[model samples]
Target: MPDVPLTDEPLILDRQPLPDGIGERLAAQLRFIAEADKLKTILRASPLAAADRRENDAEHSWHLALMVILLAEYADEPIDVGHAVRLVVIHDLVEIYAGDSPVFVPGAAADQVEREEAAAERLFGLLPADQAAEIRALWDEFEAGRTPEARFGKAMDRLEPMLLNWLDGGGTWQLPGATESTVRAREAGVVAGSTSLGSFTGQLVDEGLRRGWIRPDEA
Candidate 1:
């Protein structure tokens, strides 16, 4: 007898219908995890000492949201404060992947563009199609720093660190060899983003000097 021929049909793995509302539930869970993961990045970026307590991503988002509420009056142009708040919340999510690049680090600043772009792709890819697109757009808008919302969001980013350093006795700036000119140059982004806040930052710098939080070079 000739050798028996085997069937050509492929074997099937287990098959079943998805549970009720499974898609919705799964999406919700993914969103929660994505949001939580972002918190990790923000805390890592924040330089707050362990004794002083660093603000995590979630706290940073909330603080920016509050700033939108409290400082709307200072915006240079009319802004959708609500939209601005949303921008701030998602702006740093990419840091979860790229890690926070401090503004003062020369190489860190130079590499930020490529690192952030890659991070945005991975971080925002976690959401459902529509949500991911929406968030990615918002992140892009903030990076462009063109629209009023983006401008304000960028301004807040600068303002927060300046305030933190000022409050914490030059928290990060107090490190040996940190200089006023360097601090001001790092903060120039605020002026480029929002003139109003940039002016405020100048005042803060002046205050920082008077308070001895920072020192002028050659002093």
Candidate 2:
């Protein structure tokens, strides 16, 4: 047999070296892109507000981050509020591309997965590989609603719109001709995520009726 060289095998590199500050540069690039794409929620047509008065995705993120802080104490299950907050802050980043889907619309959610998945690839891809993967994982977790943090994050997501509708005297609900059953169905998962939040939502619904924000239609 021909003599085989001990070092004949090619050396496989364990990892590729990243360019200096590549992660940070990519993070900065993503930050700027996200800020520029702040059009998502703001583009939503709101009859209650002036034609120009719309909430941007950045504002939505800030609102939910605050909600996570304010409502963490009321969670039915113990959650790392920090993680939940992070999830909320990033959850709708895809809406920067996919646009916000009104929750009351039936079948609208069916297209969300495809739109958001593509958005995720583009948005997250702006970051360096490892950081992109991490953020993408968190985003996916929030979408899946499987983890405790994700459940809490989703609960907050639903709760914010309910509160907004109530405060604005059924703004979107009025436009969408939202019914009690529709509201209930949209929010039932929130209750499943956190019973305390569910109870609070029920109270809000009662308050909405009392305040003339909503009314019961004939059965």
Candidate 3:
């Protein structure tokens, strides 16, 4: 062969010539981001306000984050909106692996915490050590619902689906086995977050009952 050069051979892949540490960290972060994107595909039992299709975990999280910005003033206690937004955005990320659990589904929530805990570990572990720890901590805080931010985050979470269901004429509430008591019980968390939101949801549930869209609990 005439004047064969190393440049003539193509590399197996187009790899960036980044520093080892930087490259490794960037790869890990990218992998986590890719994995997190799956949340957009995981559907929830609740439908969009007026749309025929059901909502996905990613949309729910985004809605809760936006609601936090607009409704923070209604919280029973003052809240840190930035922190609340972060909590809401990451709150349902575990659902990407554990799957969505309907609030009014009988016996469905019994082992939900356990399943989500395992999912949190696996999913958050995809990030670099520090980032993984930070996200896991935020998730834990939201689950605990003790801090003001966490409480407000939860309020937004409960309020979004409730509004959608109300607007959709008792969307999930009309599903078989769903009843007023079961939904009220599950949504008790709303009052813990914001009394004003709690009142609004209570009114919606009452309206759903009067309209005969929601039946009384069999229990």
lDDT of 3 by residue, 43-80 (tens): 88888985798888888999998999999899888888
lDDT for residue 54 in candidate 1, whole number 0-100: 58
Q: Report the Cα lDDT for candidate 2.
A: 0.68
TM-score order of candidates, best first? Answer: 3, 1, 2
TM-score, per-candidate, Cα-based: 0.78, 0.76, 0.87
Q: Could you tell me how far off, in angstroms, the CA of residue 191 lies in candidate 1 after the best superposition?
A: 2.9
Model 3 whole-model lDDT (C-alpha atoms)? 0.81
lDDT of 3 at 33: 77
Q: Using lDDT as the measure, what is the rank order of every candidate, best first? A: 3, 1, 2
Q: Which whole-number lDDT from 0 to 100 does residue 210 have in model 3?
A: 93
Clashing pairs in 2: 42-55
- Give candidate 2's error at residue 44 in angstroms: 3.9
TM-score of 3: 0.87
